[model samples]
Target chain A: MGSNDLQKQAPNIVVWVLLLALPLWLPYVGGYMELGSRVVVLALAAMALNFLLGYTGVLSFGHAAYFGLGAYGAGMTIRYLVPSTGVGLLVGTLVGAVAGAIIGPMIIRLRGVYFAMVTIAFAQVFYFIAFRWNSVTGGDDGLTGWTRLPIHLGFTTIDILHNPVAFYFLVLAVFAVAVGVMAWLLRSPFGRTLIAIRENERRARFLGIPVDQHIWISWTISCAVVSVAGALYALLNNFVDPRALYWTQSGDFVIMAVLGGMRSFWGPLIGAAIFVVLQDYLSSQTENWMSFVGLFFVLVVMFFPRGILGIIRRKVAS
Target chain B: MTQVVLFNVFNGLIVGAFYALMALGLSLIMNLSGVINFAHGGFLAIGGYLAFTLMPYVGFWGGLVLAPILTAVLGLIVERVLVRRLYGRDPLYSLLLTFGLAFMFEDGTRFIWGAQSLPYQVPGWLLSPLSSDYFFLTGYRLFMVVIVALAVAGLFYILNRTRLGMRIRAGTLDLETVSVLGVNVRVLRNMNFGLGIYLAGLAGVLAVGQLGLQPTIGSSLIMPSFVAIIVGGLGSLPGTLLGGLLIGVASGVTTVFFPSATEAVMYVMMAAVLLVRPRGLLGEEGRF
Candidate 1:
């Protein structure tokens, strides 16, 4: 029992240690701060997606809509509303949340694959808007001429604009808060209900849980978190495009969650790390990278369907 | 102005026909086997590309017939080897597997044929407008519409009349009952999948003539097809057909007034359908 406890705790310790010392050892491993930041941003997105697919037991294939909404929301806020990065994040998150809340009712009736189909279809509306609304959105070339500004924290002015390391830390702090809230929610009664619904909806409904209402709420929360990830993504690159909101990007996020092991808390982050790194390397190395990525997806579904964490957990259980 | 409107409406109907054709195939597979076939568009691309490659050896008419058959053969192989294993498992796995295949198929086509759009040649007579006044009605467009109509008629005839069609419909309604009655469930599903792919292949051959052959062709048409399935209601082949045409006309008409909202109009119609009748216009209750 004691050894089991130690084994369970080891992953947490190792994960934190790696994250904390990433900057120090990254260069030694031929990695840069920007790449590290990209991993965190994508990991957050995948984790946010996992909040629905993994934890809540919902499959939303159109999350890129909310993610893109957050991005555009943040970009538009900074460009048009205010120059404040904090305000941009807030507006961006709210925009995604509001969209999700509105769209949830129309889709809550669908189950499984139908729900996924509808979500993917609905997501195209946003992509079209972004592509067609050229004056504001910058169309296919992407929204440019905007950059993240220095953050003023009352006492100290942190110049996240100039220093890449500062930006990475800022991203990390946001990620921590977002992930912390998700963890706290998962432990609550409400969170348990979400899991219960995922496991067996009829049973949960029989137990007096308002299944549809709870799912709608879960869907909203998932979209909201993914939107925050989207906002962070825009801030990371200082640009947003229609492709960011496309269905293919949604597929990428789903693959990340599945690749990491949906049942585990940090599995998506691990998956994101591997996927982002592989994609970065592949895109740099070959023009046929898409075929490789697609092949990777097939291979994973065939061989690693349980995911890394799932396999590890199984071994431990046995 | 009237001529332009008529032209677009006619054009929309043609586009809608393509949507209906693709969605029908998708609906067939989904109804029987419970797989979304995300790579249906990819199969469509393969059909078009195969036709392109074979045109030198087998004339356009020959390629048109042979390409879809070839594509259907490939689809059978895929369903048997890869997709067959996923049955009796969660629908999620099948969707994901197909999604991956979609990616591979897109990239594979691009690798083989090059990413650039290739022009597909038709007979010179087919290119000319049927009449000078309503110049939008080219011989090819009319020919496409007639072919689609024939295909739909043939499909309905098979489903309603033939033994294989009855078996498929029966299997869709109750697989357990059909299997208990001595129908080979595995072969039934494989054949059903092939039937669906045949439609996709047909769409591909028709589509390339109008849209030109490109790797991204499948991805582009996929969304509208999904909308057609949703709007038509799940599990209803006729509804899928109607939904495709309705959205096509809607978008076509939209171009007359607000050109920018053409694509958005389809989703708007889908949203309206969901609002009014969530089960869809002709969808059976509780089918979803």
Candidate 2:
């Protein structure tokens, strides 16, 4: 029984170990601290998306809206309202969550492709706001001049700015908390109810589960977690732009979830890691990296639909 | 003030016509195949670029006629090779596949045509205003409206009159029933996709005449098409058309009152429609 339990825990252990030690080993493997931070931030976003997409069987192609809102929220809060990092992160998460909650009721009734279409369209509203609101959003130039401030804990001060390693740790710590909460939620009874809906909504509805409400909750939770990742992303770059909320960015998040194996908890993280690394390498190698990245998406959809971890799991099971 | 409003309203009509053209194509493909074709815009860009490339050989009129046909052919090949495999699977796969294709198309166009916006030469006679009094009514603008009206009429005629169109409508309503009654479902879907892409191509060619040629042209125009589909109504082609024209005019009018809200007014209208009527203005029951 202990051995069986250890087997189940093996992947989790390896994932945490690698993530905690990313800054240590990344430099030796031709990777920088900023890249490690990017991978973690994106992975968090992908995992948050998978919460709704994989577990709840809801496909939101407009998650970039929430992600962007969180980014703009954090950046704006820091730049205009307050200079504190904690406040920025809090405001960012709340803004995205509140927006998701409001939008959820209107869209929860839609299923499949219609839901996707509405979400994508709704995201454009925010994009245009950021694009046209020149004074506030900085328009096409993006919101600049605000840097993530150092945390002021009672005992100590961690200077996230001017220290790449420190910033990476801050990103990792936030990632850990967000991922931990998601993991906890997925293991709860509420999570099982979500899975039931994903597997067969009609049956879950027949069982009196209130399917739409469950989906609404799931969608909001997913948006909130993704916003947390978005806040971290703003802090990492210290710059936020409308591009962060673009539909293509949403597509990137979706691809990460699918490429890593959406069904598994750790799948999107693996997917994000591979995608971030590949994108970094490709952009450096050629100007036509968009084509290569697009080609990668095609290859994954056609051949690797079950994702990398999915293949491994099947092989091991067999 | 009146002149400004009238000019914008006229401008809105032109933009709306483009949206309707693009939306109609998108609606046709979506109704039949269940694929969103995020690459629809990419195909539109291809249509424009193709016309641009062919102009040197075929002249402006020849390019206009040939480019859309050529674009339709490419669409047929793409549907067969890439989009056909994922028909019965989750719609997500197809959406992603096309999303990837959109990226490729944008990059490919930039690579071939250079990222800088290129000049597309229209006939010199069409560039002149029809009259000094209605100076905004350039011959080209009027010409575009006539072409769009003719294309729309032709589309309706085909849908109502032709056997292929009858088969397409039947397939959209119930593919399994249509197949059981001896229609080749695959062929019907393939042809319908080609028809849709043909429209997108046509929109592309006309769009370049107004907006100029750029790789990013398709992406910029696609959102309005989506809004048109949503506002007009799903599963109703006429609704798509009305939705397009309405939003176009609405935005155009908004420009006179609040310029920044020009792009935003349509979205506001869409949200209002969705709030009041979730299925949209002319959307049928249970389509969502």
Return the lDDT, model 1, position B116.
Answer: 99
Q: State in Å the error of residue A244, model 2.
A: 0.3
Question: Once superposed on the true structure, which residue ranges of model 1 sit more than 4 Å away at CA?
Answer: A1-9
lDDT, candidate 1, equals: 0.92
Clashes of each: 0, 0
What is the lDDT of every predicted structure here? Answer: 0.92, 0.94
Among the numbered candidates, top lDDT falls to 2
lDDT for model 2 comes to 0.94
What is the C-alpha lDDT profile of model 1 across B1-288, one tens digit per residue? 999999999999999999999999999999999998889999999999999999999989998899989999999999999999988876767888889899999999999999999989977899899899998999999999998999999899989999889999999999999999999999999998999999999999999999999999999998999999999999899999999999999999999999989999999999999988988888999987
Sort candidate 2 into its docking category. Answer: high
What would the per-residue lDDT of candidate 2 be over residues A184-277, giving only the tens digit for each residue?
A: 9999999999999999999999999999999999999999999999988998899999999888999999999999998999999999999999
Could you say which candidate leads in DockQ?
2
lDDT string, candidate 2, B158-244, tens digits: 898999999989888999999999999998899999999999999999999999999999998898999999999989999999999
